[model samples]
Target chain A: MASSISTVPHRAGLGHRLWQSRIDYLFLVPGMVIFGLFILYPLFASQWFSLLNWSGFDANQAFVGFANYAELLQDKYFWDAFARSFIFTLSTVPAQMAVSLVFAIILNNKLLRMSALFRTLIFLPVVTPVAIIGIVMTIMLSPFNGPVNIGLLDAGLINRAIDFLGDPNLVLWTLAGIFVWKWVGVTMVYWLAALQTVPAELYEAAKLDGVKGWQVTFFIVLPMITPFAIVIALISAIGALNVFPLIQSMTQGGPYFASEVMEVYIFRNAFATLNGAVPRLGYASAAGVFFGLAIMVLTILQIFAVRYLRSREKPNGA
Target chain B: MALEAASSAASEYVIRQPLITPRVRRWIVSALLAAVCCIWIYPLVWMVSASFKTNAAIFASEGLIPSQPVFDNYLRAWNEANIGAYFFNTLFVTVGSVLLVTIATAMMGYVLGRRKFLGRGFIFGLLVFTMFVPQGYTIIPVFELLSMLGLGQSLWGVMLATTGGSFVIFVLLFAGYFSQMPDELEEAAKMDGVGFVRTFWYVMLPLSKPIIVTVIVMQTLYAWNDFLLPLVVTLANPAIRTLSVGVYAFKGENFVDWGGMTAASTITIVPVVVLFLFLQRYFIDGLAGAVKG
Candidate 1:
């Protein structure tokens, strides 16, 4: 679309046309400058830094070509962190999408009352900082003394307080649960917006044909919102891959690094001394580059996959 | 006779299905929704209630209400924990970043959406591509850049970093908005001999109030809640730390000060929630616009 727009021919001389469009360039100056200086520069620079051996502090840097990348490939902890990150993404994205879809569908009902209040309340968590949620949840879900355990124990649902953060097996899943709880509302909002786009006339027609609720939702509503579902899934997947502050504040990838995701792994290596290890900026950069490229590839693939599905479905539906 | 007939008709309309009536269905749905709302809101309510309770009471009691609420926690969190300083620092960065983003993105969106120019597609595509790059990937070089600029460990440095990244959403929102606007207004301004920049300034910009508000609200929530950039950039400086970082530090410092910690959490979160409640219509609409566009 933008290419076509830019391809429009002008009868005027090239210099004159360029002069006429100078204002457009003027408007783009600040955005382009900032993007170049901050976003673009850092992006490519990280790739270069990945190939060099440099402590983030020292000016005396060693140019070790591909050594950092090679180390990352052999590093067990890096691969473990990558696998954990992948697991986190897989676990949270689908669960968050499902829960958000359910909430959105419920709230979309015309018979539902006080929907705005429910939505506002649900979305409250999204506005709260993840770090704060981590801290509060850490205390709220603390074993032996936390309210969640206390409530469960008092109700006789459990005999003992569950070690939500301390137990290695439970910690990652627990973080995923908290993440879903916090972010489901944003996805709900997205689904709600998509739901509104499904014309009411279609529902009326379906009802007139004596189509039941679940069938109508399955055949009509879901298909109508499939594009939105794809976008939401993509965004949620990327977001889950970037999980950091919550883990940092809550567990710091503790209990033997069970909850450590890619971002926390990168942060710990690049900035902080962890477990008697000095900061490894180069190694962290390599990990970041690898993870980033993986995400980019995944995103591109998902985009194409969604487009193909949409095109295939177009024959039978609008 | 007419009243009796109307009453009888109303009774006829109230006839129910065999399994469940419409009224019963509505009641069931409402009850279920209420239950879900309660579950969703429980943690926030717990946070607020626990903020007023003693540390022992917070752990001992599972109730939403405190046995004997006090203001001491808030007082301590505000005065001793230096939450007030963090609040100001967060406010400064959020405001600065929002202002910069709103202005820059609005102008960029205007040009990209309205003007036919060279490399427009390339610029827009680049922005879109950056959206997929995980934020953490950029942190290393961004830190290095800030250090080179001598802005590291400062709130302004954090703001610069915050404003630097993928604001493509705002640009997309504004562009989608501006494109939909009829060209007649700009054409009229052109006929009146208004220059392109002036036309955007005097006419298009004034008409962009809704999108502007949307960008401001969304960006405010983003900058205010952001943790990673501030944490990284201001790692060496505790004095300029944002609320999120402050609360995280407080947890480490006073491990057992649950009341003070919750109080600090509530303090940081409440303002955003309140702001959201007031401007939710614009916020939701803006978000929908961004997604749909």
Candidate 2:
């Protein structure tokens, strides 16, 4: 895409000097200025604030060399949150990706008559407010009066009613389950879109050889959308790492901090960790920088892997 | 002997099986799919049902339809979530941001789509790159930046900050609703010596309805469903709180208002639900374009 765009010839004339168009610059200025002030400057602030010992307040002024990072290294909660975040990324990304891919495959089968309706129904969760989902999941996962427990108990599936949010062992998985439920549809949508771009002729070619449905799906469909599947997986993984608001609304990183993730920890550290949950700017900033770096490294590695595979396949097929 | 000989001769004929038959297997598959659909739709359906349920029914019944449905909870929820104000704030922001971003992106997309330039490669990359960077990665920076601008907790700040969402613009251009124009129309316009602005105004904009509609629906959804930005930046002020934030607030402040809470949630979901059911063809099409682009 980039190479094609780059090869387009540049015409230099009063009529054709596109850059000279005042409207272009005018359109750009508002977006650029806002992004620079809000997004770019704050990105630099992580480095600046990392150097300062000032708590996350504007009025305070103090300079301490590497103390924030040093303190963070010693923080047990930080490590715990990092571990939990990773665990979530591990569990949720693959489950969500696998489930969504399966769903996409099932829906994308030509034999399915109501593909559009199925696609739309699956995607409804993506459109709804995340907060509302958080609320519903909280109520539904509560041990008492929660339908999950009631149904399980009614069917004699469990000897005991499980407190999903209360048990440290279960809380994270519960959260992961909810996350999958919320996100799998979104992944399916991306996969479905990518699936449509696969030519029908590929399937016809494979079918002519007497290949079964699953074989055709695995060999032909999967490889064609490998780049997209990888991209969506990485995005989901990153989202899991940065998850907070749902944690806050549902578990509040609770059941003895069982469900704590990096983003939730960062929020708690900043706005609610100490002193009636007063803001701890310096500490939170330092943590944010730490987690941000960790996430950036993870995301970049995934991107490179995707790109490598994509290009490797490109010589043969897109 | 004759019958036996005929049966032996016809033994080569095999029983053929259809992919799906109107039988027990079909019944099981449909039943299974129906059960799964119910499970999938359960939470959302429960939210709607619970909103109509009385306090006791909400706490007690897990029925598909409320045992005792009533609208009183919804009425109370309107007051309880402070959601009336939230709706106003959210609507204003969603609409206002869509307007600002769409218009700017359209003009930008139009120019970028139509014009050829050096470093256009870089500009398009820069625009597309924003979509990949999760807003959380930049929230702290964005928050601090908003605070510095003295627009902290202000609606306009939220509107402006999200202006970098060039997605709609990017999609519109790449989809090339503009570029797909019959070159003859543009050639004829050029022959008439119409200025570029006049050409875009009279010709391109009129012809760009499919993409423009697509962008409008998509950006509206983005601006509506976005949670974290408001969660982070709008900490101090309550006036600018959107519907999602308001729902979050209700959950936090009032613990036992399950009926009221889901009621408020129902209100939060109403516009999107209606829009989705009614305007879905375009919404799905637009969303497909976003991912597939």
Candidate 3:
């Protein structure tokens, strides 16, 4: 049954339709107000703010049209941080998707005992606050008497203690590894949901056919779940970009700016006055707007991709 | 007779061999998974252990068991670091935001999902459009807005801004759920002469338990763990900091106080962990629902 007033005939004008469902329109007011105030307004205001020379400290502000954006274009540090954000995403998203896909497969096994317990264990970190995880990891990965370093040394895997967060060369990779650990559960949950879409009857048929486990997985299950990978990858890439809290808590983009991602860069420019440099809210806003535009483009691309996939799948009635 | 018996025994041996291999393989997989799970949660376990240790002991040992346990770190984090107050702040903000989002989204989703009225597509399109807009960059304007409204240094501002996220995902979840509800329920409510608001309050809201729980679980984790918003909002007022911001601030101040840091971390983490443990099913369902939406 179509409850929508859209079922009304074309003869019913827009005014009549709206009058028929005035209460429905009223229901939307609160959400719309909040959205306008918080999201829509901020969205435009940020673009406007990017054009000014404001320190975010006082009212002594001046309008500087596109100056911040100009500086951003030439700013080596901004470019490096932007590249580093991509680097973090490139490194972590694949690793997280691959690893979590494996866990999802394992837990999806009916023969596996206590799969719920294992799933819960892997997911515990996801529920735990990232700020807390970063702090705990700092201590847990400390070079001296840290659990991870000690375990590595005892196993003869390393000749000396490794500074996971301190060494500039290793810090970004280290953060990437921790990023995988902290967020793997989320990707795993996605995989688990995708895995559920695979029909049980297909697995049963494979068993009856005497299909080898590996062969069945590669031939049957993989193809069935392949469609979900694109969406899952997109989600993961978005999540990977949001490593601000984790990085902030763990190292604050330290060790001589080796691990500074875009978020850290934006934050430092906007709020932090480090090394006698003044905080530049306008510059940071410009950087943010630039990054936001890039994300918007990516999202548009995603929309097109999703539309293409859906169109392709529709002929197969999938 | 001897030949027949030997042939039967060989068949039985073949059957036993395959069975034994699978059983052993299962044992191996279980053992491996168990080990990995232990290593996965080791940091959390270590955090708890380190919280009980003195700074010297924490530095001297890598063991999961503390060499000498002490309550000083807890006391220090609670009193000196003000984690106790932050705990209350986090609770207040989390509950307020959850309630706000829940009520607002329920109303919006109920209307959008069930009643296709004028401007519905426009509103819905706007919601979906904003979802693509990266939220991290929008903080400056939100901060400015709050400051202009004189909520710059208050927990109330934190609550409002935190609730004011482009929660299109949650709204979609609610919309999807409401759309699936039986039409007869609303039909019956209308027959009883129930008004629009009363129908939602009395029928739709209660019937949408799964969606409500999903929204609450996800929003609680978000509001509880949200660092950036709380950090920026409460930057001017130390007294109103949430656990996340407070813990970060505590870490910054006591860089060398590993013991105290761990204690603060433990304090910040325990409640949510406990909440997850109790509502683990709901959390998984919520996540799955979110992905599906």
* Chain B vs. true chain B: TM-score per candidate: 0.91, 0.83, 0.90
Docking class of 3: acceptable
lDDT (Cα, tens digit) per residue for candidate 3, span A1-318: 463444788689778877888898788887777788888898889899899899886675789999999999999989998899889988999999999999987776645667789998999888889889888888788897788898899899999999989999999999999989988988998887776666656666676676666666679878988888887888788778888999888998988888888888888888776986877888899998898888778788888988888888887755
TM-scores for all candidates? 0.93, 0.85, 0.93
Candidate 2 similarity to native, TM-score: 0.85
Score residue B156 of candidate 1 by CA lDDT: 79
Q: Tens-digit lDDT track for model 1 on B1-293?
A: 35323422322232223467756775787789899888887888888999999988876774788878888999999999999999999999889988899999999999888878767889888887887777789999988888888888787789888887548778887888899888788878878999878898889888888788888887887788787888887788899989999999899899999999999999999888888888888788767766676
Give the CAPRI rating of model 1: acceptable
What is the Cα-based lDDT of residue A37 in candidate 1? 75
Candidate DockQ values, in order, are 0.41, 0.24, 0.37
Model 2 alpha-carbon drift over 4 Å, by segment: A1-23, A110-113, A205-209, A315-318, B1-30, B110-114, B118-132, B162-192, B199-214
| Deviation from native of the Cα of residue A310 in model 2, angstroms | 3.3
Candidate 2 RMSD to the real structure: 7.4
In candidate 3, stretches whose alpha carbon ends up further than 4 angstroms from where it belongs are: A1-3, A316-318, B1-21
Interface RMSD of each: 6.8, 9.7, 8.2
- lDDT per residue for candidate 2 within A236-279, as digits (tens), equals 76556646767777887887778878777777766566457656
Q: Distance from true position, residue B171, model 2, in Å?
A: 7.1
Q: Taking the tens digit of each residue's C-alpha lDDT, what string does model 3 give over B90-188?
A: 999999999989888888898888887778888888887777555568788888899999998899899998887537777888888888888899889
For model 1, how does the per-residue alpha-carbon lDDT over A1-91 read when each residue is reduced to its tens digit?
3443455564667786767678789899988777887788878999999988888766757899999988898988889889998888898
* Model 2 lDDT tens row, B1-293: 35323322221111112464424433554456556767887889888888888777777765768766788877777775678888988888788877866666666676566665445557666554433444444666666777777877798778766654434344444335554556677668889999777887788787776566667766777677767777766677877888888888888887677889889998998897777678776655554555654
